[model samples]
Target chain A: MRFQLALAACLLTGAAHAATDIDLFFPVSVQGKLANEMARLVEVFNKDHPDIHVTPVYSGSYDDTNLKTHAAIQAGKPPAVVIMSANFVREYVISDEIVQLDPLIEKDGMTEAAFMDQFWPALRLNATEDGHAYGVPFHNSTPLLYYSVDAFKDAGLDPDHAPVTWQEWIDAATKLTKHEGSTTTRWGLMMPGTYDYCGWITSGLAMSNGGEFYNTGYGGEVYYTQPSTIGAVRFLDNMVHKAKAMPEGVTDTNAVTTAFFQGRAGMMILSTGSLSFVRDNMKTPYRTAFLPRSLVNAAPIGGASLILPKGNSPERQAAAWVLIKWLTSPEIAGGWSRFTGYFAPRIAAYDLPEMKTFITAHPDAKVALDQLVYARGWFSTYNVVGVRKALEDGVQAVLSGRATPEAAMAKAQQEADALMRPYVEQTALKVPE
Target chain B: MVALTGTTERPVIRTRVRGRVRPWLTAYALLLPSALFLFGFTYWPVVQVIRCSLTVRGFRGAAHWGLQNYARLFNDRHFATAVVNNLIYAAGTIIPSLVLALLFAVALKETTRLTSVLRTLVALPMLIPLVAAASLFAFIFLPNAGLLDHYLAKIGIAETNWLGDPSLALGSIIAITVWKNCGYYMLFFLAGLAGIPQDLLDAAKIDGAGPVQRFFRITLPLLGPTLAFVLVIATLNALTQVDHIIVLTQGGPSDATAMILFYIYQQAHQNFDVGMASAATVVSVGFLFALSIVSLRSLERGIHYET
Candidate 1:
């Protein structure tokens, strides 16, 4: 009996040792159902890959995920993988807290260039640095114009033809807006003016107005006071204060979406990532279109990417690679894309039959993916969130009628410049003539 | 095991010596768990923060020397805005919260059947978490269709963007803080009132004092220490209870609701500027510490424990 018990214990220990235990940290920045879906996806991955046991840890928002991941890393208990905000990858690269996936790709019998080519071209800028992949693009988005078909039809505008230019968009919004005496019954437009989202939509507008919010290639400069940016802010201000087409002051995403669903808003500019949410919750008939532009079509790329945080043992790193590959495989990527509103970053994911069927049924998803042609890099600089908030704060003030576009943008520029000065002084200004 | 002979006592004596040493050893051994925890988690992080405040992220070594982070913060306009907003927030939340709490406490002091229900209803806000309370208020603050706007419209008031407008956002946040905190603070005042001698108020009434006069002369005078303690707590809360601000405005419509701790959190997590965050923390704690000390010293000096 003792010999039999020992043999059983030996077999149990051997089986336990065979499986690699790994933790994957993720954040629910999108919506509640997506968080549930993420947990489900992990369960499926674990079930299929019996050799590896992956535990999905729900970290908080994008910022919270970064904090928890960094803390865990510094405490010498780094997670095997993290789904970090794409914009934050730069800071992680600077801090040397993220590992490059080049060697991992090579080990998989793929070149780094070929591996990255699987993703949309726009995502490459944020995912790869110094010709090495530090992050794998999982989900990505660009801002798009969403308009209510009922509101459009009631306003004497063609529901089939969406606004394709800023002038037409303003005119459409003006007609769509309704008022009874002095009180507004329906706002013509609504956009989230909170942090992160505020900066994102503003950058998209700035880019469409033929300007860059920050240097696309550099991490130490912003052009907040430039004509394009000021013009963009003025457009937003006019919508609220001048045209009275939009609500005055800062509206968060939840409020914006609620208004859109209630028919309190005629049109809205929201992230493509919100597509799935709007589709599921919106009771009114709505249509998605390219963001109406002033000069050129543009959208700021938004979303998170799967990353391998540094300080993993070779065995753990290898296991993490396998997990990342499985998650980013076109089958899973396409499924996630359909489940969430965010478009699949992997180009081939769209070619899948299910993705095609889903896009056919939901024309909104097609508009989101089609807009990828106009999508550009998001604004990422030294002290990204702070610098982004500087502009956001100014925009919020403008929305509240506290400051004019010129003054707000100028103030925003000064604050952003001051925040980036240390980095600039260290790099750009360090050279001797 | 008891030794009766002197010869047996020597080995037993050594055992006694060992037992005596063991108590001292065991006392330290018992202390080790809590002492190590305090040192590692609390004292150590504080020391590290203080040390880090003196330096910035560097390449070669410990980096920049003294006061640079402080100097940088002094010049930043947002830092100035944060300080001014913090002060305004403290005043906005503290004064209204205390006065309302005192009013509620006075009304519900002798909790009977109706007063008990009223008190429970009033204290209901205390049960909700700060984030939930903030979220509840956020829905109420919504424009046009919101509860506040809907009710205000009935009174001939036009739609108001409670959280969206820069001018009104801080006031809205303050209202949420007051609504949540007043009920919690009211219980403390109720306890204070319960401890007060009712006979003193009766004597004042017998001496021809009016209700207001009796309240001022007997009731208010006896509640001085409680008032001082609650004031400190309320003030500290006003400075630190920022979860509502996070959920509602995110310190915006142009940094209107930004507090010192919120600003520090933004620095540490959002900006990833640990040195700046640590410096802000030290200064914030220093300012709060000084304000608390001054407040207690000035407010409690004249009070005497009567109950």
Candidate 2:
């Protein structure tokens, strides 16, 4: 009788713990080796959860990851989960390609309010579409202004006082730039002007300059040719052509970071997500400040979110849910936050003991967290990439001296409106006659 | 093997047609695999692209004169710029590459102990993928502090944005494409040189011709077919070799380096306007087809054989 009871218990345990494997397509937008760290975390999760196993695939940049996920879904091989750019969540929801996490939250015997209470309130705008949770904010960042202390001192300026306004920024850059017979030994300021980074930084500039950049609440509109945006573009043009403090044309992220490390650029604008990378790589003393404002203080929220794509098998979905919960739990979230420079998306993660210790150890991380008060939703639209590239192309032309600010801004507006027109017509224009 | 025409005394029915079909069957069986794949992946996709090019996107069957997508491009300055840039890109890369390739092949024509190694060294760039070559060139030609700029500054030349400046961006891309294609094209020139009878050069020498005169008189005329072939290939390459622009410029600085193929890609992949992309693709294919026909007719006339 004792032997039979032991056998029955063993059978029950075996049946309960059958493993289900799921794929997680993730992209590392920042410099740190987050892909390897993600793999290590997934390994730990797989060991802890015998019923669910996860394999993390490192998709390239944010845009590349979006493309891969869309292709995979169309090919009928959607991954169980994807770490997608937060701004792309609405488009995916509109396309009906992602699963609503609200149902999953309710299935776990929890209220939507109770589940969403775990994360910061500001994240809800990008994480949900049509009043339903479609994405879980994984990590988030806001743009920060990084200035070299040594360079500032060399320019006879106080290192403690960073630029507070666009005029101050241009003045500080001009002062910092060392010119010897029409040669610049060091640039006053530099920012990445390449594709995704270009658009993000440009939008931040537009927003800080008292422009909405686009309709944040709706996907069908943008305010590109408005006075505020035109002014922002003019400011950028002045920085390159008139001030001669910043480099002309597009500077990629690698170039920006490299220039910063070499002391070739005195001040640079970069994501707070790169805080850890800069902290690790920079041998010079540097400090972070808020983005200089022309009219109002604003910085767009930027970062990725974990989402469940549709077409996943029920078994795979269950496993993915288990994996997502484990990855976003307070302990993991806090740990990832410390590992990377991004502030933890979950509010409860910051309350963890380790997180408190981390914030104390690195006060620079706190700056990004405090900037959260001014953070706004990223631009998401009907056709996110197409609409975004229209502006990016025009801004690149302006930076490269190919078009005037007025022409480029107006052209960008026209192109963007055209790209959004089809969707706009389908919904906004289609009405009962 | 069955003999169909042989007299069958037992009155067995003989199908001579089956015997006749055996050879054709073997030939078709050999061709079936490639034919199926060609139809599936290549020919079918071409049909689809052609059909899509004629499609009207916004409203069903609402194209303007069956040319809405094509008509829309006429007013686009970017598209117009891309067409002009592509033509310049073709001429710019082709002339320099062919001239440099001929020079390299002539200089390294002999199979001496040193020339053979030099020949291999000259051809090394072809081994690298175009995308990788583009990446390598990006760092070399980077704007402020690139490898090329660093060296130029060392020589007291003012810093120039090689790939960033509006005027220089296209030239910069042209230079990289030349570097990439010269080696590949040189191999063909080398082959053409090898096929030339050495006796013709000897005869030219006997006729009191200098090296330049002999080259122009004998080697040049003999290499006409090869030049025609290489020109066609080079033209196709000019349209398609957009990897460098993609990695380096992305048709930027106001569409300076935006060749037609890259423009089509931008419209389709980046802009997500498949209708415009398809129309642009059809335009490109039509251009290539006409060019190819002219090239082939010239190739037929240019062929020469040394008796």
Candidate 3:
């Protein structure tokens, strides 16, 4: 009789403890190896939390992951959570594909203000859309100018003094560049110019050149035809075509890193996300500095953010929020920051003893952290991809000697304005009755 | 005419009823599984897509209803470009792949010893996974690190950016596709060649015909049916080719090589514009229908008879 009661109790508990199963889709934007790490972390999370079971779906890069997540949602198989590109958060909010996290914060007995205060202020602009938190800051990054100390010394420039202004940048590039007859032995600079990266780095350049790249408060405008953008385009044109300090056309991230590693390039502008890669790969001494200024010292903050998609069950949503809060906690965020070159979005992460030790061990990381003071939100608008492409195409043409800076920016502005017209018509251009 | 005798007519009617019932039951039994599969996977989703296209919302669920998606697609520059690119790709990939496959088959048929090894090598590309092929081709055509560019530079020629340049990007994609698909099509021609009677070729040769003349007179006429079959399949393959573009280009360098399918994928997946994507799919089906009509008409003309 006692054995029967015990068996009945066991059955009841077994039925109750099946756990709410949820899936999280993430992209390995920095390294392919991170996909395996993310999966392992999910396994640990599931093991620790008996009431929840999480599956990590290995999505592609930032862009492809966005594509797959949207496709899956359309196919009615929405993952409970996703690590999406930070710049894309605005578009998701505009489309109402992502759920607003303010209510979730309220449910946790905290105001949106208190919840957002946990993260670095610089990251909040991209994570929040129209005064509502649509995303939680995950891994964040800023563009850092990586320069070869040996090359700088060889060029008779001080290794300690990095280029501070646009003119100084150009002069340094010219001086560092080497030529054997018509063949270039070492290029002065290199950077990636693929779809997503192209738009990102260009925004950094425009921001540094004292341009508003796109409106920060609004999602319907960009100042592509402005003089600041033209200046930025001209700088690129001069580097590739005139000064011959860079490649004649766009080079991807891998090629840029390879060139830097092989000592084929004297300087390169790359994401702080590549900090770990460059540290692991470079044989020579290197230093990271803030992106050189044309009129001001500025750079764009870029990376992925954790977002909750709409249309999830209440239990799944609650489970996802728990996961998000844990993942963004100081301990986990800091560990991820050290693992990947991306700086932790949580401000408190840096206060930990381990993080302090990490910063002391890798001085290059300190430089990236310091540069964040001047960092601004990345370019995002209603038609994020279209607007960015307009500018990127213009920049590529300038790099290829196919179009002048002024001409390129003019065309780019026209195209960008055309792309943003739909949003603008609904908001800024609506006649007030 | 049949009912001069009422009794005989009754027997005939009974036989007809039995005949009809047996075949109808058999046909239904044969079609049941396939019809279920189509209903579950294809037809049901096609119906769903039609419903979704009329709705204005993100990809996930219907938030509202209108013809806004189709209207937006018509106005979208990228969508228009995608349509143009698909047409160009269909023309570029289908014709070259078919012609090259025919040439390869003809070349191998005249050779006897050790030709199997050559044929096997020709078939290797088809055996390769699409992702692997795309990745391999990406490496082979990489701007500076790729073998093609390396060789071009080594010979004092300017290295071409295969998947980067806006003008040449589509052509590079076409070339890679042709290399990947021509081999598979070659197998079809080889089988068709194997079915041809040896006597026909001998008779052509005996009737004062040389190698070229025999090939034109005897082989060409007989291969017409096979050509039509291969052409239809090749056109469909070209119309829906996505993997290579996904791997190598991701439809970039200012959207130069953006095909309709890839564009639809982007709209549905990346932009979360499923309604627009579904409408575009329906439009693509219409285009395919028109293409099938043209090819079918041509196929009818290509069919020949002999005594």
Candidate 4:
């Protein structure tokens, strides 16, 4: 027992003087290559900062990252930092699991407003909770339309002059679609229908059709069964089940991208985060356009944010702050953007020489950046994934010929309401009569 | 009489103390670390989960304990669908894997040429890590670029979307799982077959019993304990399997393959609803426990070491 006590003291003394160890948990929201790039960036950081040591942990995809972080917290092993989905920050703020960065900014001799102004105005909404900064904007994206030049030529349409409105989009798709005998040889348009991508693209369509996907001001409401959403689903149904211009059922992201590359799909709607991959993999000439709109050229904001979990030692908190600032600095952020094809949320990153050179070299990247002006807040509700899946399931049913758009939307609304009922009862439903 | 009684009592007392110190006390001391481990790792989290299951909260709001989450689960049609999918998956995986493994073991025992090489290759699927296996299957099961499709097309049959179609998605996962584990389970059956005495089999053969009859009357009845053990293990593996589902089906073509654990993951991780997710974990573990106790014990008693 005496020897055990002496050995414990020695170990404690050794642990006390060790370098500050921190973990940066990030996810590859778009592709696997970005995860490797994130690790490389951390390797550079650890080399530069001798006083601090950081481990770049690949925490699966965005959804998996959130789960790992929560389970770790519950199990009393919280990570120092996490690159959470931008929309999820709102829920974290509500849960009080995330620390407010306002005080930290003030300690650094900067006002909260001035610090928030460093990012694009659209990004601030998701990063701030009730006018206080909570998350640092990281990699960001918006939906973009990608069209194949070969398919356009085959259809006798100009690739450079991409469609800008709903009417033109439908017309171009009709023309681009080709039928050989009874089977369609080429699809006119394709988009991903997996859970995360499905909800994201659908929200983009809803926003462009002049409908608010959810009340950006609140976290408990969505207009799933509204005219705007019905119209969007109906349009997709018409394109696929009715016109046979698009594949029925769910087309995954890889499938859509593959079809586009193979000239089997004339056009596709996918994340701007995929810009780098598309540019690299695509052999033929291609062009990108803003998502076609009925009332407005709107796309939902997509990306992740760097946030500190609430429970951390003071030394670790300081270390995490240092890591976050260094990671989001103009040099690192711009480099990451060039690597991943996601636009750096930091506005000043574009002014840097490397970003400028990279943009000049890749014109498709410029189109992605230019479309940021029309980007809106992504759908974030009290029960975000559940609410999103409610609508996503409905839309999938419509594609599969299992349910009508009207019936699907109605079911979606009811399911979303039920998922949100706990929150609703606690707040909105607790009205003083 | 008194001197004889005293001598006998002295020996009995010494033996009792030795037994107490050697087996009983040492067994408890050895079990201490494991008990503490369970207390910290398993039982505590299970308690936390049970507590959280009875609570209601929004993403960032205060939680109040109630029966809301379970009630919500009951009313959720998706949850019902997930439960049904899990049951079907368990049924699909257990029966085929056990039967195939038994068949492989018997065939391997009878074969004479390159038996060691065959045995080595049979367990190859078990050696590959699950992620690699899943990724390989994902590519192999793809509609166009997949090996399965390529072979089918070559054979003049239309390609099947193994992981894409809702009806076929669960079946595809079960097939992958069986392929991955059947060979591993074959090892257990092979060991069991090796343990059976040749004298018993010779006697049965001498009585004019054919291969099938000898297997039923002599081999199967004697292999009861091994069958029970394999059945329990296979059922547990099938019940808890989620990795392949994550990589391949992702609970879709409309929740056709959403296992209970996968649904819990969606709730906790994707939705960030910890309370609901915790509740789900409790339910899944409870279901697994109930299944283990009832089926496993019954099979062991009714089938194994039969008179």
The best candidate in terms of DockQ:
1
Q: Give stretches of model 1 more than 4 Å off.
A: A1-14, B1-40, B58-64
Candidate fnat values, all: 0.69, 0.37, 0.15, 0.28
Error of 1 at B252 (Å): 1.0
Which candidate tops lDDT?
A: 1
Q: Name model 2 segments beyond 4 Å from true.
A: A1-18, B1-16, B57-67, B73-76, B305-307
**Residue by residue across A1-433, what tens digits does model 3's lDDT show?**
9999999999987885688888898988774357767877787788788899788988878887887877777777789999999999988887778989998999889988888999888899999977889899999999999999989999999989999887888899999898765556678998887777877888888888888888999998999888777878888888888888887766767777877887878999999998998898899999998899887888899988999888889999999999999889999899889988899999999999999999999999999999988999988898787688788878876776678989888988888887677678777887878
Per-residue lDDT of candidate 1, residues B1-307 (tens digit): 2342444556778878766886898899999999999999999998998998988664323576688888877776767888998888888888998999999999898869999999998899999999999889888988887889889988878878889888888888888888999999999999999999878888888889998897787888888999999999998897778899888888887888787888888888887788888998888888889999999998888787763
Off by over 4 Å in 3: A1-18, A71-77, A106-109, A153-157, A179-183, B1-19, B43-80, B110-113, B274-276, B305-307
Runs in model 4 lying further than 4 Å from the true structure: A1-21, A43-53, A72-78, A106-110, A178-185, A313-319, B1-27, B38-69, B114-116, B155-160, B197-208, B271-287, B296-307
What local lDDT score does residue A119 receive in model 4, on the 0 to 100 scale? 87
Query: Which of 1 and 2 is ahead in lDDT?
Result: 1
Candidate 3's docking class is acceptable
Poorest 10 consecutive residues by lDDT, candidate 1 chain A: A27-36
Superposed Cα deviation of residue A352, candidate 1 (Å): 1.7
Per-residue CA lDDT of candidate 2, range A1-433, in tens? 9999999999987885577879999999899989889989998998898778688999988877888898899899999999999999988887789999988999999877788777877787889776778998999998999999999999998988889999999999999888766567788998988767778888888898888887867788988898888888899999999999998877777777887888889999999999999999999999888888999888889998999999999999988988888888889988998999998998888888888988888877887888887788899997888788788889988998888988988898898898788878877788999
List iRMS (one decimal) for every candidate. Answer: 1.9, 2.7, 4.0, 3.0
Tell me the whole-model lDDT of each prediction, alpha carbons only: 0.88, 0.86, 0.84, 0.84
lDDT (Cα, tens digit) per residue for candidate 4, span B1-307: 4653565546777867765776876798999999999999988987888888877875346778888888777776877898899889888988898899999888888657688778778889999977789989877875544688768766665545577666777898989998998998999999888888899899989989999999998888778888888888887887677888888768887787898888888877776666667777777788888978987788777664634
> Residue by residue across A1-433, what tens digits does model 4's lDDT show?
9999999999986775488999989888785388777778888998898778898898888888987887888787789999999998988876678989988899999999999888888888889877899899998999899998899998999888999998899889989998765445578998888888888998888888889889888888999888988988888888877777787777777777877887778999988889889988999999898999989989998998899998899899999999999989988999988888889999999999888899898888898898988889888877688888889888888877788999999999998998788777877778998
lDDT of 3 by residue, B206-288 (tens): 88899888887788888887888888888888778799988877777667788899988877765546788899998887788
Better of 1 and 4 by TM-score: 1
* DockQ of every predicted complex: 0.61, 0.38, 0.27, 0.31
- Please give me the DockQ of candidate 3 compared with the native complex: 0.27
Worst 10 residues of 3 chain B by lDDT: B1-10
